[model samples]
Target chain A: MRAWESNIRKVVPYVPGEQPKGDRLIKLNTNENPYPPAPGVAEALKHMDIDRFRKYPDPTASDLVHALAEYYGVGDDQVFVGVGSDDVIAMSFLTFFNSEKPVLFPDVSYSFYKVWADLFAIPYETPALDANFCIHPEDYYRENGGVIFPNPNAPTGLLLSLEAVEDMIRHNQDVVVIVDEAYIDFGGKSALELIKKYENLLVVQTFSKSRSMAGMRIGFAIGHPDLIKALNDVKYSYNSYTMNMPSLILGTETVKDDVYFKETVQKIIDTREWSKTRLTELGFTFPDSMSNFIFASHNRVSAKELFEALKKQQIYVRYFDQPRLSNYLRISIGTREEMEALFAFLEKYLAQ
Target chain B: MRAWESNIRKVVPYVPGEQPKGDRLIKLNTNENPYPPAPGVAEALKHMDIDRFRKYPDPTASDLVHALAEYYGVGDDQVFVGVGSDDVIAMSFLTFFNSEKPVLFPDVSYSFYKVWADLFAIPYETPALDANFCIHPEDYYRENGGVIFPNPNAPTGLLLSLEAVEDMIRHNQDVVVIVDEAYIDFGGKSALELIKKYENLLVVQTFSKSRSMAGMRIGFAIGHPDLIKALNDVKYSYNSYTMNMPSLILGTETVKDDVYFKETVQKIIDTREWSKTRLTELGFTFPDSMSNFIFASHNRVSAKELFEALKKQQIYVRYFDQPRLSNYLRISIGTREEMEALFAFLEKYLAQ
Candidate 1:
């Protein structure tokens, strides 16, 4: 290594899914919403004062926070916003997971968890998930620096009951417990309801998946004011202005149009149900997904072959080459027409 | 303290300039650009397809990065983008300043540098700037973990000669040296040209002051490909999608309008020269500022009294109550008309 290289923080970053530029391909790899954001988001951008670009945005992000608080029926102090859910969770890890004891999560949770832990030098332990890709509440009951896990966990798309989630939180009341609810709006109930009861519990949600504003990069956390304050302290110290002008204005606009928000979510849920039945008919088996995506393994064809075949046809889906996931493919629910196209290709490819 | 609070990364966050919402105020506190961003930025947003909000923006920020690369005449691998210059510098601290040896910077510099050092648990020492608020080249010749300082230092708005900046970088070849050129476009030359000769030198700049996009949240770093790569690794590990779609697209449009960019920078420079004559005539002393703002102290009147007096009239300027800065007020150079309004008030107040 060069002399200067000796002190460099060497890290293997988490590789996000490919965002292929071509519009012709069906993009289901990143679990993005197939629908557009609220019409107000478009209208807000159109009418925005471009002259304001000369001034700095509000570091407190009060406008977006207030809108979120009103929608969720929480106090304004309970809300914290960031560029995206990744930014929120990363900030939480830095702010809360500083103890000597290992932070805890599922072995097969969102891959970014381990990456954050490593980046911050926060010791972490991952207890193995059970055979059915379900988290065991007892596993997180032991000593830890903190706790964080995705609701309706990624790739597996399996969710634990609310009681189990509460059990984990109750056992680890001495440390912060973050329930990342990126997929919660898809089907599962959010832990936001329990924020009043547990001061250490933080519920994180994003506009990326259910709200169809991933490209806009809006995410937020709701918790006791103390926890939110701690996160904001770290956030302000790190970067005072993570949320830009368009995001703050447009995100507030998205929150105002709850009717449109629910409609798009219901459409995705309906498509997910229909896709699940079709996948079963094609000899695929997987966990009952509570997320926008389905993780499936066919009894016949190897997942690698199917992944390559799908890619060759300009269709994109997520496939992890790691243990316990290599044989499965994670497919995000697209529109009915898009799902039909996926199914048509699968039926022909599997028969061959 | 609460049990969970014991492990919280407690910190005193950097307080950014107050972004008071009232449009009636003659704002000149933060040193933001006085003019709006390139006209093409508004045009791009008006014509943008809002349907793309459903997908994640390019994590690589390719279009913006490529635009910046072309403008700077560097390879794409040599450019790095982030939410703002603060984010870029914070990421650099976490990436390049990891050795046991303490990093070095000016004693009185951008306050956020110390906050980041404390936040990341990186050892650092602030060598005092000369009594003139100027960086001494010899002070940075000693062994260190890393080195960083704003080119035209904040609050003081005094700039170091390019030779002095290069001497510091040459002496610290074994460690990374960052030249924060946030106000470079105002008058000073950038250390960016030295990136090819010294691989350890990373030059960071922001569009906030020069290109007029503070509300949009865009900043970039140009350095050797290796340094850029290291910064990117940490950035991705922190948040893959730091640049949202609007920023990516609009920032690119700003870069494409070189004529507008130069015109605005020249306008601010011209305004600064004109304001200096007026301030001197009003019996104030200040460093020979080469930045968009003038940091000045009155010959008789107290800065605190002047700050409050201005605030009462809805004219905002910055006053730091800390050591050496208590008597000084940093007034950003506004439009000719706005500066005349400010002079009108200062003349009446100082005479009284």
Candidate 2:
């Protein structure tokens, strides 16, 4: 190692899902929305004057923030915008998880949670999920520096009820509680409704999953004004211009088209429901997920074998090699034709 | 105060130059490029497929990174891109400045350096600049965690000699030395050539000032492969997809047209030279600037009064209220016509 390497802040980075190049595959590993973004997004981008790009973007991102605040019926101060939910949550970890006590979250949750905690040198403890891959509210009731977990949680795609989410928040009122709602728009009710009541609660959502703008990189948090102010303080101190021009303009355009937003979400939900029935008939058992992805384990074939076989056919799905999760595969809900292709490949491979 | 507020990472955020709304105003505060970006940037955006935005942007920003590396004649592994240079330098600070010893820079350098230090809890000491607002190589010869200073330093626009920069880097070989070349394209030569000799040196540049893409938020750092890898690791840990799709694509296009890039830069340089003569004729004095902006203090009028007087007429320039900078006004070079309007206004105002 080099002498200067000794002072380097070493970190094991969170490996994102593979963005395989070329368009011949049924890409499903990353739980991205199968539909395009709101049509207004395309219209907005087409007419955007690139000349204005010579100037710096609005650092406050007021237009997008106001759009989100109006859509969610919160005050403008109650929202914070970032590159994505990853950026927003990472900033939250830095801003609110500064106490000496260990922050708490579910073991089976968005994997980035632990990475952010480690990167920031914040002590954290992951309480194991119950046998059914469900988060127990009582597990988070203990005293901690802060709390955070994804709703309609990743891999399992199971969601905690609003009351349970509130129960955890009420118990941990002394510390900040972040509800990562990346997958909330699929079917789950957002914890945003509870923000007015809980000063320490922050509900984060993204345009990546349901809004079909992952490539655009927009995410936001709706919380009490105090939490929002603190997040902004740290964000500005770090980088004043985190959200660029196109994102600010196009993200605002996204919020204006509620019809397209709802229709796209419903289509994914419909596809997911249809997929669950087909998976059950094929001898798969898994949680009844509310998110845009389904997690399943076949009755006979090992998930590893299935994962490799599917990869050979270019029908990609997420398979965690970690303990307990090795048996399951998380399949994102794609278009009907794409799902049919995946099912066709699976039926033939399993029979063999 | 709320009990949870104690855990909040409270910080005094850096205030950026005001981007006053309205096109009627002549904006010259932020040192942004005076011209639009390469024509290819518009062509690329016009043909972009918004449908592809449903997927996540490339986490590595490979196309843009490779393009930059090829353009700069560096290996692909030696390049790191981010939302802007602020994001790039912020990540560098997080990745490389983790030692217990205090990092060192000129006291009058980019104000954001101190803000990043405070935000990350990295101890830093700012040595005083010389009477001429120039960095002395010997002042940075002592022990510290790291060193960073802008070339053609901000709000002063005074360029340090390449030999002086190399001397400082040679002395601080034990720790990372960052030469922020934000305004390097305007006149000063980059320290990038020295990277082959010094593995500890990192050169950061931004398209915001020269390539005319501040709104698109494109910035990059070129250094040794190891340093680049360390920056990527910390960046991934912070936010996997810092550069969104449009920025990745548009930034790549901006790099392809070298002719347009050079012409735009030369235009700004010519304007700066012309403006300097005019400002001198009007009884303003400043360091010999090798940047897109000139930092000048009027002989008789107070900078605050001039700043306010200019703002009333819709011509904006930056004025610092802090000690030492209170008398100085940093005026960014705009188009020749815009500069003419500014001179027209100033000629009468100064005479009065």
Compute each candidate's TM-score over C-alphas.
0.99, 0.99
Residue-by-residue lDDT tens digits, candidate 1, A2-103: 899999997996677788879789988999999998998888888999999899999999999999999999999999999999999999999999999999
Model 1 per-residue lDDT tens digits across residues B1-352: 7899999997986677788889888999998888988999889989989999899999999999999999999999999999999899999999999999999989898989999999998999999978888889899889899999998998788899889999998999999999999999899988888998999999999989999999999999999999999999998898999999999999999999999999989999999999999999999999989999999999999999999999899989998989988999999999999999999999999888
TM-score of chain A of 1: 0.99
For candidate 1 chain B, which ten residues in a row score worst on lDDT? B10-19
Question: In candidate 1 chain A, where is summed lDDT lowest over 10 consecutive residues?
Answer: A13-22
lDDT to native, each model: 0.93, 0.92
Model 1, runs deviating above 4 Å: none
**lDDT at position A91, candidate 2:** 95
Question: A290, model 2: CA deviation in Å?
Answer: 0.3
Question: Which tens-of-lDDT digit does each residue in A235-345 have in candidate 2?
Answer: 999889999999999999999999999998999999999999989888899899999999999999999999999998888899999999999999999999999998888
Please compute DockQ, using alpha carbons, for every candidate against the native two-chain complex. 0.89, 0.87
> Candidate 1's error at B246, in angstroms?
0.4
